[model samples]
Target: MVRAPFLFALLAAAPASFAQQATLSNGTMHVQEGTTLRFTGPLQFTIGPAGALINDGLIDLGTQAVVVEPVGSPISGSGVEMAVTATDGPFNATAPGGLGLSLTTNTATGPITVTRGHLARVFPEGDPSIARWFRLEAPGGGSAPVDVVLSYDATELNGLSGSAIGLYQSTQEDGPWSSLASTNDAAQYTVSATLPAPWDFITAFDQDAPTASASLVARNGVEVWPTLTHGPLFIQVKDGAALEELDLFDGLGRLVTPAMHQRSSTFASMDLSGLANGPYFLRIGQRTTIKLRKE
Candidate 1:
């Protein structure tokens, strides 16, 4: 009986293995995440391979530092901890950075992007001290992790020489874009890119030139080269859209549908059930050979 009492005591004193977790909710708040976390909100905590901890309104989570692990950097398994010490009270939150990850209650002006995990590349919208333009080539699809090509237009205006371009993606448009591969020559270059995955939109930003845009129209790829004639471009997705009157042409040089008939531009689907499954061309206005295929 005496041994049994002692055994129970030992069990009670044993160090506990915990999956550190916390929370901040309701009234006045305090939060810590990774290693750089400190908040005045009621909802904040951290997590890892282990589990998480829930924190009440006010609680000291010890002096252990929190960290921000790079989502796509060399520190794969490593964690970046941010330490917070409250000798008296919580630390004030600094205005969040604009690039990469952003944390703030800033009023929303427009769309918010959630990307730019790597810190290697960053650019200011109009930083005279830096190169600010780049381009992208997604040959295969519109998402990422697949094959894609990147090409740099020109960063500086006056010197305007083509530089290396690499593929990049960002969850947030306002943040940094991830780099993929570099395509050297502008028009002649062709590469494959795994699309960024079911994003409402994919934008190509260049650090050297004003802008460049490429899009898929009717199964055909169309790139609007950023030049004095038509630079700083954006791609518009047209799906069964209607225009006043527009011309359409088949793949062959011969005009299947002429500009004259394109007035009020009604394009009924050309019946392809009778044709073999193969590549066809589409001609629009001055543009020609928009490769279309039926399968």
Candidate 2:
């Protein structure tokens, strides 16, 4: 019943290396804020029934396997609790090949494990850009919703831009994958989403398709360029009239205001970097509403 904070609590021998495997039979393990607990190698790390992990820091399991055994004896009907908080920092868990998870969850009924790999090579229902998957397993599920942040590499985009990426989840490995309302950080190559319940499989997909170079159209003395823009959108007034008012609407016609917008007498630009990839309607002053796309 030793209650040490981190790695020292488990391995009292030599420095943990790639050849060793750490097993926790029982007791609560805590990873304090700003600290990182990493386990690397081909061996498996197991946490038995009487064991628990409370992580508020980063846990890097580079190509390693972590098994959280189920607590058959549910204490007061609550089996085992493993709370992972990822909102405070960058991300909590990271695996090989650019798969990461910043998960927020409550108690679990059974074993919980994370594996990196693709469930299917090609999913025709969603983005065909990338095919990597991160599978999280929790038998009976948890209490609160889980926030997930997945990072990716530009090479894996399959010719798609990073800003056009989003998260998609499916209960099974095969078909019927649904898109999640996620925010993409093109600079960091990360996509984030909040799942109401536990999902079996999650992957990154490109929600916006590439448009032809001729999509840019100008009318009524108002001009916009590179219709398929990655971030900054430029607007110019051909007649040199004040741009007056400007507004943006999403695919559903929902009004969305850009966080970074600058305007002068006849020229203006909006930073569409934080926006999702889709078709949007940009309204300029009165009587001029041009259609555009954001990637």
Candidate 3:
């Protein structure tokens, strides 16, 4: 179906899905706040010139793609969005692969275009397994810091540890890849990173593990292992130090009572199977806080 000025304002508890290919040839398509517009099925969405997408709710593209022709009205507004899983291949104009990557812009000057490909980029630090490179741009070539959420599939890791993988950004496609301080969800197989500036390319790479000695000491002589843990979180004290008390806090700083935790003079293990997947803080007695992630 085609709507010149497609204004979708929904109030139902469930989201509405577009099962077939839809086209917004002209005017604007506004998704009102609190609603969800999900695109499903094996078809693509086309937004032509003079056509815009203003999302105030959720625009969920589940394994689907959108084609926003150049000079087309841009996708603007502060809202939630979801992307598709990337595939290895050339840039398919009908379905460019910015898979599992979502962007939130505070101030958008024009439409945003994201494309993913295997462009043979250089990673001087190391190589990425099953890497799918992504490129993002908008009208008039821009500049601004933006927060991005990117995801990966377990199968894509290709025998690499999920926690060891991180998002790497580069100014050019060929050389010098820098690691971003990323918040990795070991359980969910996703990573979140902030782009301090405009980047030419971004992809995920497996980072080298720290030396054994460095890994053995976290802070205040406390050792925390597998910052990204699936269930149990291991803690150890060094230099003949003893752990006084252990306190667990959620990402919001709210105290969380761990269902199972055992502590000795030098070692302890906390059961994280009961907690949700996300970031957390593990307090080792007084004056020390070690960050932990449960996936």
Candidate 4:
């Protein structure tokens, strides 16, 4: 059976704005070839093999992460392409490999506006070797920050235990590059940081090791084992106080494991076989949170 492509069009003639949250549960939301769609709140959309989101307008994702999922599509493997024309002012584009590139306001206080025809050029004579390059303009006299998140595939990164990645920012795009503070989420294959200033171009590459290591401390007589693991995770509490509640959350801040009660025991384990390979957080009691990885 042939499935017709689902299309949601926003024409320039109509010129609409979504002040609250909206979702495109299933289907493609096409921002017509020459039109614009402004989103003040969160905008969630799903892209499948037969669906796509082509934006040629000003989209403001606000403070929320734009969730992009591929249903029955190769988006998670090969990735999708988002072209920002020269006229498109300040737009953000995130790829399947967990790469989020965006040009937003300086304050980081307002919405990110992407105007049409705002083409970002590769720095330093447009190097052909660079896999991806983007150019962003600072809002007039004020400066803006360029944010970059380098995400890797868990299977390919070897469970994020021995892999290292770095994010570099450059003003000339080819001259000298400055390194930024990046947090590695081993479980989920992502390293991200925000550049302090507006640079010509920002890029990410692998490193020998992470700049900062995950800290393991004994809090409230409880300690989590194998900060980095490819299988089930173990937690132990020295004092035989039963855990009031336990919770597990994915990198995107979604709760993967529901709150559960545990009897007074020194040791407990949770199987991660059902969850996708990535970084997760295990919260014990009410405050202690530990990072865990699944391969």
Worst 10 residues of 3 by lDDT: 88-97
Pick out the ten consecutive residues of candidate 4 with the lowest summed lDDT. 121-130
lDDT winner, 2 or 3:
3
lDDT of 4 by residue, 1-295 (tens): 1123564333233213322333343455545434534333333433444554544443433333243434323122111233222332343543311124534333442332221122222222121112333333334412556455554334333222423544545555453334455676666655667765544555443433221223343566787656555555667777777654777766544578632233345667767777777655566755365545565
lDDT, candidates in the order shown? 0.27, 0.57, 0.57, 0.44
Ranking by TM-score: 2, 3, 4, 1
Give the lDDT of residue 80 in candidate 1: 23
Model 3, residue 202: distance off in Å is: 0.4
Over the stretch 105-127, how does candidate 1's per-residue lDDT look in tens digits?
A: 22221222222121122322221
TM-score per model over all chains? 0.21, 0.41, 0.41, 0.35
Q: How many backbone clashes are present in model 2?
A: 0
> Model 2 TM-score?
0.41
User: Once superposed on the true structure, which residue ranges of model 3 sit more than 4 Å away at CA?
Assistant: 1-98, 118-122, 209-295
Q: Rank the candidates by lDDT, best first.
A: 3, 2, 4, 1
- Lowest summed lDDT across 10 adjacent residues in model 2 is found at 73-82
- Those runs of model 1 whose alpha carbons end farther than 4 Å from true positions after fitting are 1-65, 68-100, 106-116, 119-239, 243-295
Candidate 3, residues 200-254, lDDT tens digits: the string is: 5677755553212213336657677767677777888876866768877765445
